[model samples]
Target: MPTDDMTARPTTSREDGLAAEVRTLLRTGLPIRLAAGPRLLGLRGVQARARRPDDPSSLARALDGLLREQLDRLENTGLAEASRLLFGAEAATSGATLTARRQAAADASGYEVHHFRKRIEPKLIDLVAWQLRRDSDTFMARHATAPELRAATRPLVLPADVFAWEAVEHQHALARLWGAVYLLRAELLTTARLASMDAPATETDAAATRALWRHALVLAAAAEYRAAYGAALLDRAGDTDLGPDQIAAYAGWTPPLSPAADLILVRLADPDGSLADFTARLDAARGGSELTADWRRALSGRDRDTDPNTLPAAAPEGSTP
Candidate 1:
């Protein structure tokens, strides 16, 4: 999730600025303010994932995700509740102003508005700021470790026709992409199950649904990448000038779908259904990913004239291919 935009880890002074920016965004709770907020705007990785860098809604969602993650880590229920109320993280208070949110927090926590403002508000903002700092560190560490990790992994045995470097790059990208998809899929399943029990819609529920949308976006991008790669392969095989439909007919290399993909496709078509609704449809379909089975079949198959013994042996664990 980290981007290439950050060249160095943030300093304590930079974190203090982030905290101030977070406080301003929380106080305004305006999309425009959030979109322009220096701290949020500086999250180039998050912005790059959005449909557009300037999208206020996407920026707001990212902010919400950070807050929710921090909230989930809190051990104190009172602080969590007060923080949620103060941030208008619930549907009922989402449209409330800063003063209204403060009063709500005060009423819920049995504290005067002034006292809550002087005590709780600052702490909540600091938490978010701390999370930002932690995220920056994580980003830097990931980049730092990536080269060593790649060096440790076995090299992929790609088709001879494909460019080795390009294939390796694609393989690495797909590995990360599918990892995200599966992780999001698990989260969706858990959240869907919780929704099936008839729980009230909370900010957490909304966050999960938004996460599904993000999963869908990633899938869509993967689909596009696969199509392009397939087209290139076809061209290399002397099959040129194929139309979109023709290319799509060659489904052997297509990204395999699961229940999550089915639900996402339906939601993409309608765009109005909730997580619960999608869960019901998904249950009816009872779908699962075919990726593993597909890979096994591809790897196990051979031509009639080909000798099985001539093929390369499997790469040993931790050995280079």
Candidate 2:
């Protein structure tokens, strides 16, 4: 007697159907764990190879590695490196540099610098989030884990080591978000720590000037609007002291945030000139450039941006749109 048997290869329709279903699930932002081997394999293949749908796993892994590297850099690298291109680390932080402080803290706490949750701000959080969004697939994979998602929204104070082991998703969006927050907070804390040292900044040279400007850009990207302004004030003068041209450059480097911008202007205001005249000179020095009016509201103590009623009582003399 012959056994009844059917052997047939999987059809094209079956493969196409599977691909379509996988795409739909990915669009919904579900976890890969919910997927079958075929789907996961396809997704991974697409992502790992940089094909369409851009593998979530690949993106996740990339972000994970980047975060890890950043933490390591923060730990192993000295403040001199971290501070080199940004604010004049030595001057801004007094004689002590970022490397020194991290080392000091590490020594005192008996924990690796990477183990502590560094103080950071929301702006950095935004930056990290923006970066994570660039790798959509990785973000989706990390999103699959509920605990990881929650952890991201509310970051932990512990260092990278504790979380590294739990590696739920590489380039975890939640992790990246939290890491950004940590970085921003740490920078602010570091700045404050430096300020509390209470030593007048040493005479900053041209090298320091360039560093401070670079720092200003980093702060701007992190949305440390105030810090960006503060860095400008701290480095406003050269080794020779505040000159006419240098002062103008400081004003132009002001962050786009109105409140922050006003603070810089206030800090850099010439003793002999009125605010109006000061701003005019600033404009002249910068070839008639104007600070956007919207930022003016930040100076006036309004929490929100400038609106119709919030317009300056009158534009400063010599002001142009």
Candidate 3:
């Protein structure tokens, strides 16, 4: 009945170990799924046979665990925050309509124009990035040794302001990449489910995702502090070469769960005050940082067309490695 009771009264080592694992997975997985009733009870039965050599309980349970883990992660990490951000008053009232929001900037003043360059933009990007960084922490907490967490933490630092800046930038960048990636992931999941109807997602899809993935990877690699890695990833992603395969890999894209959506929605909701308010918020969030450095350099007669020789070659444009 109770978790401790089951493990404490274990029948055999193999059974005990299996039961413990099943419980661990359920404890973690169920919460992630917000599971109740049937799913929970169903897993219990699966757990029972996990120790039976004749039963495929262990493998089946592992699959369920994996699926549940992914589902839970989707719920807990990004989707959760997205709800708040998107529906929040601010994002809902921004000056731009969905049509306008989707339109090209055409000029330098509309909400569509320089959305990426706006100070608020990067703040939102960094907000999501930080949340992601935190998610990484939770993932590591379960498996990381003490020293590892300490060492890992070294690279994640950001002046709260700077971290916040990249958070906004990355969020928009991700949005650009999201629609395409979701379509791909949906197709992959569908095919995986109906193998007879369709082919499984191929290595090509994985390759297509290289640009976005590599951008994220590079940011993680270049961060001044461990925590900043996520920020770095978001900021540098724009520079990465996008390709077909890299595009396909991003099919699983989902809105990040963070305060970002709230900001966007807030701006959307208050057509009158959204810009002014968002601008003020952006300034508050921007504590001192070199955030505008790249953009500044771009504006100061620096060639956007030429990659800086000082900076390492950006992964051969679209090459993943």
Candidate 4:
């Protein structure tokens, strides 16, 4: 929407639609996000917020409605426009204009764009899991002293969809979330998507730059959680019965499992699954599968995040890893 590009070029219908999306988020989405939260400040009242661990028939209806709205938005939204609103200033090539940066994302996304969606699929699955963690935390904080907690646990982990439905409604809140996913995917595809093609990237390339992004967000999230909630919340971030695998569905999530910080590590752990199958596999895993660090070993050379000698060696596949 900000029409200032150093290089002038013809625009397509999708480009125009992207510009409209940018305008919509900047105008409408941001405001809606600022208001909807655990506080429920601008939203009507207590009745709207979930009170217990139970997911009833009416709750299913509400979540479905929320999902439909979110899917509609996701269907219409452009990855580039989203980039502009979220990290465009940071992601933008320093010398390029806003229009140029946006155009670059659109180009990287491709004309038809369905295949391009595949690039970001795994990260989005991880996003849903992280979103659930945050939403459960928010929901519990809101109902901290609720009567239901007398019979249940603090920071009660609810169904993943409950958190996801709430997350999609607060667009700006989830921008950093999806931004990390998009940026990570683009980073992985630099050789295939950017270098061999004719396009500009607002960001991507330069491992140092990519590493900076990786650290920057994680540090920010960790610091924000500590500042917002402090020592009192730290005691609640755990569960004795759960291992890392089952923790996804059960943690109270103190300051550590911050989506931008800790959960990003899990997202980075495996980047191979296609989105459609990835979510299904995660659901199956949650039902009962040992989480393993085999994904970490899959990395070769510089892709390795940790020294092989330092990490526990990978377990054999299909065993109770």
On residues 230-277, what C-alpha lDDT tens digit does candidate 2 reach at each position? 222221211213222232333222224334443343333433434355
Q: Which candidate is the best by lDDT?
A: 1
Candidate 1 vs. true structure, TM-score = 0.40
Candidate 4 versus truth, CA RMSD in Å, comes to 25.4
lDDT of 3 by residue, 1-321 (tens): 101111122243233243334333322322222232232223332333233313444435534443333333432232332212221212332343323322322121233334423532233223323332333234312111111113464555557697577775555445434433444355445433443333333432333232223223222222222233332222221122232223333444321212332222222222123334433442334320121122223222233465533422111111111
| All candidates in order of TM-score, best leading | 1, 4, 2, 3
Q: Model 4: clashing residue pairs?
A: 237-254
C-alpha RMSD by candidate, in order: 24.2, 25.6, 29.9, 25.4
lDDT of 1 by residue, 12-34 (tens): 52455877777877875532335
lDDT order of candidates, top first: 1, 2, 4, 3
Candidates 1 and 2 compared by TM-score, better number: 1
Candidate 1's C-alpha runs over 4 A off are 1-15, 30-35, 54-57, 72-77, 141-169, 172-321
Question: Model-by-model lDDT, in order?
Answer: 0.49, 0.32, 0.31, 0.31
Error of 3 at 154 (Å): 34
Off by over 4 Å in 3: 1-163, 192-321
User: Among all windows of ten consecutive residues in candidate 1, which has the lowest summed lDDT?
Assistant: 312-321
TM-score of each: 0.40, 0.19, 0.17, 0.21
